[model samples]
Target: MAKITFHGAAGTVTGSKYLIEAGQAKVLVDCGLFQGMKQLRLLNWKQLPFAASSVDAVVLTHAHIDHIGFLPRFVRDGFRRKVVCTPATKELAKLLLLDSAKNQKRDAAYLNRKHLTKHSPALPLYDVKDARRALHRLKAVARGEWHELSDPIWVRFHDAGHLLGSNMIEMEIRDRDPPLRLLFSGDVGRYDAPLYFDPSPPPPCDYLICESTYGDRDHPDEDVLEILAEKVNQAYARGGVMLFAAFAVGRSQQLIYLLQVLMHEGRIPKIPIFLDSPMAVDATRIFRTFSKDHDLSEGELAPPNSVLDGPNVELVREHNRSKQLNNVKGPAVIISSSGMMTGGRILFHLKRRLPDPKNTILLGGYMAAGTRGRDLQRGRPTIRIHGWDVPVRAAIDSVSGLSGHAGRSELLRWLKDLPKPKKTFITHGEPDSAESFAAALRDQYQFETVIPQLGESFELGE
Candidate 1:
């Protein structure tokens, strides 16, 4: 018999981990980090529910930070097994994990230096050395092939369309007369999103685990291009700065692509766009390298050069150069990372620009609770960050269509072809969203649905 456990992302939108044990073999799917809420972020400091050394392997579904950020910590605690993922995901994970470690180390140092930490000396969750060690364990597996693990356990990756190399994980424990199959939806990507292919139909499964980030809500019925042009033009006409908080991985690339296309079509005039966050600059190169992942055809506007050549996008890397951007008082667009405004250079930009009523803050994706992005979306008067509460005077807005994760309708469309599993566990959303979606699955589709609690476990029965 095989049992599954939800270690994280059970009742929240971040820190995704699912432990599956079949027979004598134990493996984890998506070792991720808890983000947004400080209480959740502190959970990263706690010991993992399962022994790191006991798991035979980790099958990574993709390379988004929320999906794979805890890897360095897991590896540091003696996980010696192979880290399996797609080739593109492996490459991107290296960039993301190292960047995460680097940022954490810097944060810890800043906290210790300022005497802001409770500990005598603050320490990062995992250092660059640990990230590199985790990178060393990555074993790239091609999509669509059933890779064997133990005697009766096997797994496969399907196109998820969420990010450059995202996939839907399918694991089968071939023990009983008909092997018990399990499907894990790794941030189901929307169909026809810019710079990416549509999510593929899932393979058959006896059980299903899926995300509900946008399960209870549908995206606003507005043309994203029109909205972008209006916002950009508004910022430009007012001679004000336009700041964007975007995810370094999927959301960053999507924003750049949209800007490129908008410029090409003359929908919006090209402005001086600054691509802050070194991780985003690096991720753009990877997106260009993996051209086949996107929906672009031959000679369609690609990333890197596409964004650089057309939009006059400048890469902000050096500390001094980034600092200079704070003095940028013009009709320009500044794109920064850490989408939820949790931490990163985005904080610096928000601090400098939030008080300016003329400026605009464009949020690109879903912001979890306790994040500054969510606060801005909720029209908070001020956002507290790093011991400072910055007053919000900037015009805060969000473009719904640019989100990498699928909304309610698209998620249901993805579920259309799926075989009626014996049970469906809805996770990776807030409690209300998860419970609502669970009810929807049960009422509308007649599927046996469950909203798993954090640390909840269930045995797969035949």
Candidate 2:
């Protein structure tokens, strides 16, 4: 029998870790960081649910901090096993984890200096050394190849299309006496997302685990390109800078692609665009390395001096260059990372740009509750950043349809593509979203579905 447990991201949007045990060999999937509320955030420093040394291996879905953030902690806690993922994920994870470590150190130092943290000394969850140790355990794998885990189980990865190296995992297990197959839809990507190919539909399986981040709601079907063009035009008209808090991995690349297309079509004025995050700039290079993973045609790949290379576009790779952006006069566009405004260069941009009534803060993805981005989205008049309360007079706008995750309709459609599984477990969302998705599956798909609570475990096969 194979036992599966939901440790994190079972009833919440962050902290995405899952434990799977097949006899003596135990595999952990996606050891992500806990984010948002203080209660949940504290979990990051708490003891892991299970003994890290006992875990034989870890299977990663992608490089997003929410999905891969806690790896360094795992290593620090004694997880000596291989952390397996696609080559692209490995490259991207390195950049992201390093940036995460740097940010943690910076935040901790700031908190201590300002006496803003409740903790006495103000410590980072994990240090750069821990992150580097975790990198030592990383093992790269290719898509479509089945890798044997044990006598009873084998695993394969399919292109998830969520990001450059994202994947949906399939595990075929021998049922002691009868065979069974299990599939884990790590984080499904949108079908029409720019720069990426569509998510692959896996073959039939006996049991399935899927994400429901947007399961309860449908994203507006508006054209993001058109909306972005209008927003840019307005920002330009106001003669103020446009600050975009974009997730570096997928969202930043998608926005750049859309901006390129709009610029090519002459839909928006040719204004200077600055990509300020060094991590984001590195991620863009990684994306270019895996162009075959995207849906772009050969022609799209070879465009001369394209948006990425446009004369007006500047790639800010140095800290000094990024800081210089704060001093530049407005009507230009700036895209930076730490999408939720939780941390990163975006905070510096916001601190400088948010007080200007003529400027705009463009939110390019989902913002969890309690995050600074969410506050801005709700029209909060003032926000605290880097230990200082700053007035929020700038225009806050969101381009929602650009999300990487599929919405309610798209998820159901993807579900329908699969042959009916004997059991389906809905997870990786807030409680309301998971429950809502479970209800929909029961009502629309007529499938047996369960929303597993944290620490809940179930044995598959009889």
Candidate 3:
């Protein structure tokens, strides 16, 4: 019998691990970390339900830490098998994992010095060396091609359009009488999103697992360009600085494209723009290399007016240059990463800018409940950063339309393209979002959908 288990990301947006046990082989999918609240974060340090060393392989869906975060710890725990992913995903994963490890170590050291941690000595979840070890086991594969895992199992990846190399995976398990096909939608991307192509729906499968990060709500389809232009104008008019907290992968690039368009149209006043995160700068180069993944027009990529080049844009690739940004006075835009205010250079920018009413913090992605971004969004008057209480006097705004995840309508439309799935599992969101989506599927499509609990397993075919 073939059985599937939900390890993480079952009823929450962070941590995405799933286990598949078929015949004599054991395969794991997406060994990711649980992020957000303290309760959920504590789960990251807990032991896995199954022996990590016993798992023969891991199939990665993308490079996002939420989807691939726990890998180093998995490797550290004694899993010595190949971790499979797309080539671009492998590259991006290397960057993300190393960055994550660095952040953990930095946070640990800071906490220990400040005596803020409950533990006697703060410790990183994993170190840079652990991340390096994880990278050695990564095996790159191309999209749209099927590779045999064992006699009964074959896997293929379809472009998910969420990030540069994100994918929706399909696995064909042959332990049943006629074999059962399972599809795992990693993280569906928004339709008609700039730069990237829309997610391609895959062939029909017997079982389906989909994410519902934006299931409970639909984003307003306002003129994002106009809104951005107006915000820029208002900030510049007041001699205020605009700080954008963006995900290094999708959100940062989208902001760059939109800002370029607004600049071209002369909608906003000219101000110096800085791309401050070294990782984001490196990610931009990778994005340029993977132009095939984006929907950039021939004109957009041609000559002097490429999105990467603009009148007042500066790429801060050095530490000194980044620190120099703090000294610049008035009417400037700075974009940085670790979108959720979880960890990154963005925190430093926030610490420096949050106390000034002449500055604005623009959030360009979803912020989990326990994150500083969420606290700001919820109107918290004061936020603690680096163990210091920082007053949030600056204006905070969110561009809701720029999310990379698909909304409820888009997810339903994608599902309608496939034949009726025998069984469906809804995951990768808060409990409300997942349950709401599952209910909608049951009511509207009459499909057998269930929100599986963590460590719960289901036996496939009799």
Question: Top model by lDDT, which number?
Answer: 1
Could you tell me which 10 consecutive residues in candidate 1 have the lowest summed lDDT? 296-305
Residue ranges of candidate 3 with Cα displaced over 4 Å? 297-305
**Best-to-worst lDDT order:** 1, 3, 2
Per-model TM values vs. the true structure: 0.97, 0.96, 0.96
- lDDT value for model 1: 0.87
Q: How do the residues 304-405 of candidate 1 rate in per-residue lDDT, one tens digit apiece? A: 345345538888889889999998887888999789887899999999999999999998778899989999999999988778889999888778888888
What local lDDT does model 2 show for residue 92? 96
Error (Å) of candidate 2 at residue 450 is: 1.0
TM-score of 1: 0.97
lDDT of 1 at 236: 80
lDDT per residue (tens digit) for residues 320-437 in model 2: 8888898878878899988999888898999999999899898866678779988988889899887689999988888886788888888898888787888999998888888899
Estimate the TM-score for candidate 3: 0.96
For model 1, how big is the CA root-mean-square deviation? 1.7
Instruction: Kindly report the root-mean-square deviation of model 2 from the true structure over all alpha carbons.
Output: 1.7
Clash number for candidate 1: 0
